[model samples]
Target: MIRNPSWVLRSYPSGMPTVGNWMLEDRPIPEATKGELLAKTLWLSVDPYMRGRISQAKNYATGFGVGDLMSGGGVGEVIKSESPDFKPGDIVVSDYFGWQPFTTIPASSAKLVAATDAPVEASLSFLGMPGLTAYFALLKTGDPKEGETVLISAASGGVGQIAGQIARIKGLDPVAVAGTDAKLEWCKQLGYRECVNHRTSADLVADVAAACPNGVDLFIDNTAGPIHDAAMLNLNTFGRVVVVGTVALADRFDQPDIGLRHLRKTLIARARIEGFLLDDHESEFETAKADLLSWFKQGLFETREDVIEGIEAVPYAFVRMMNGENFGKQLVKL
Candidate 1:
């Protein structure tokens, strides 16, 4: 009997998203089926990648059609269950069901968690897709080693924050870049060896060269504008660049600016720049989830979530995320 609002996309957004772009509706939750659980959503995620979901873009995942419920990742507590796997009061994360107070989830799509003081909300952030994305990019693709220098943009965002911290744990010197003072401070707190402000600095190549005197051995990119252009010029020979995301490109529907001078660097330095999606690493997701849970228990990882309360706030949160107003991961509590 939860009476909460649900947000559904009314139309596709071109640049910045707006409330008009989303339609709010009310609906009743149905009974839980066999091998299913009815959970109350405590927190709902709002990410820039979601913008692509609203449009019928040729994306990695199927786009959410107009009039379909606009859902994202979420952390919820099961209140009713018909599955052997899940009982009452189990915290779980879901990808398809969101923007509401309650949803029915299949046991296969939901993983039960025993909640602790760390907040089950982290299961949707650092301990989930974003964290796994960072882990694989740094360790598997980038292959950063001790004494190596690494560069990361959007260092305060969910993926970049964990990527830099993981790089440090692996004995690499991580040079972090962010847009604001508060974010730079967070990057420092995350144990990044060096920090840079992309907004103030004009000479990113010089800044990256100064911060990473040995030349960047790997680049974990979240922004692909000026910062990427600058960092590519300073890559060490045979360096690796892991392109996990482009917040800037994502805003423009992944149509980033034409060409990269970095291509020359890739050819000359024999550096490899590759992109990846967390979905491609499902086999490793469970392993990463367990490892992240351990890290969270030990306080090895932490992130800021700009949570906008109420399901009606979903559209605004999406707008804010694309506008870069929210820090870390943007989400809504239903």
Candidate 2:
């Protein structure tokens, strides 16, 4: 029997979360039944969105039941299986189970490996929900046109990075806004036409106005708050703003107040601000997967995973991500 270590939600978070809200515990694995696979986790995906899951409020899904195995998404190797569809050695990705060393799941929940040395984590990163989120949000909602200026907040992150690339692919001038100089530099290397450090900009309205002489045509908001307020002020007439995340104020289900100033500007400029859900585009996942895979093959994209080595580190990693300590995709390893 394998000992499965998992991080559980002990209490709901208030404002920024701390390690106290979670606790690590150990459990045992059972033998796989027919049509099931006994999988050993190798990597765990820790994302910022998980903060909402632990809270006692409504989000894309119902809030995770208190004390239920804290689950999101994971990639694992099948060590033993009773299903003919899966062999002893196979990798599967799913939102199946939590921070555990082992989990037994039906073969259907498992997605088979189509590529070798697939880094598996990409199933949870670029090839998974985040990638889909970025793909559809840009093409369907943000809709940047050729030669138009695209400004993305949280530009160095998993979703933001992918969105920036998609903007470039669509022939838009993509400018990324990040928290640090290093992240801004990385954005530039990733082909952003312009990059700015959110930490350094004292007057983001003036800075963005200076950077985009013609004004921003599309704004992809991940870090919403002051950046949002400032960006709306600098938006070109008919600018489209896509609200993907509101990480700037943490995971409060109640929407943040943007004040009348920015609200008035949005209306005056004839701007359209829309919210998006990635799962709504799940029907087009295969299409998104094919295009994203093509980009990967062409060496057009790369991802950073802040993967902690063990289940013991899951709490710390999560707290770190909530406080904006991680630079890219934040995940924990089994």
lDDT of each: 0.79, 0.80
Q: Give the TM-score of candidate 1.
A: 0.92
Checking candidate 1 for backbone clashes, the offending pairs are none
Clashes of each: 0, 1
lDDT per residue (tens digit) for residues 1-334 in model 1: 5575777778887755677888888877757888888888888877656766776668777887788776778888898989888889888887866677887777788876555556777766787767888888888888777879889988878788888878877788889988888888888988998888888888877888888888888899877777887788888899988887767765466354654666677889999989877777888877877776777677777778878888777778878777667788777777
Candidate 2 lDDT, 1-334, residue by residue in tens: 5567777788787778788888777866757888888888777777767777777666777776668767667788888978778887888887765677787777777787567434678888888888888898888888767899989988878798888887877788999888888888888887898877778998888888887888999999987788887788889999989988888877453455554466778778999999887867778989998898888878878677777787788778877876777888787877
Among all windows of 10 consecutive residues in model 2, the one with the lowest summed lDDT is: 251-260
The candidate maximizing lDDT is: 2
TM-score of 2: 0.91
Q: What alpha-carbon RMSD in Å does predicted model 2 have with respect to the real structure? A: 2.3
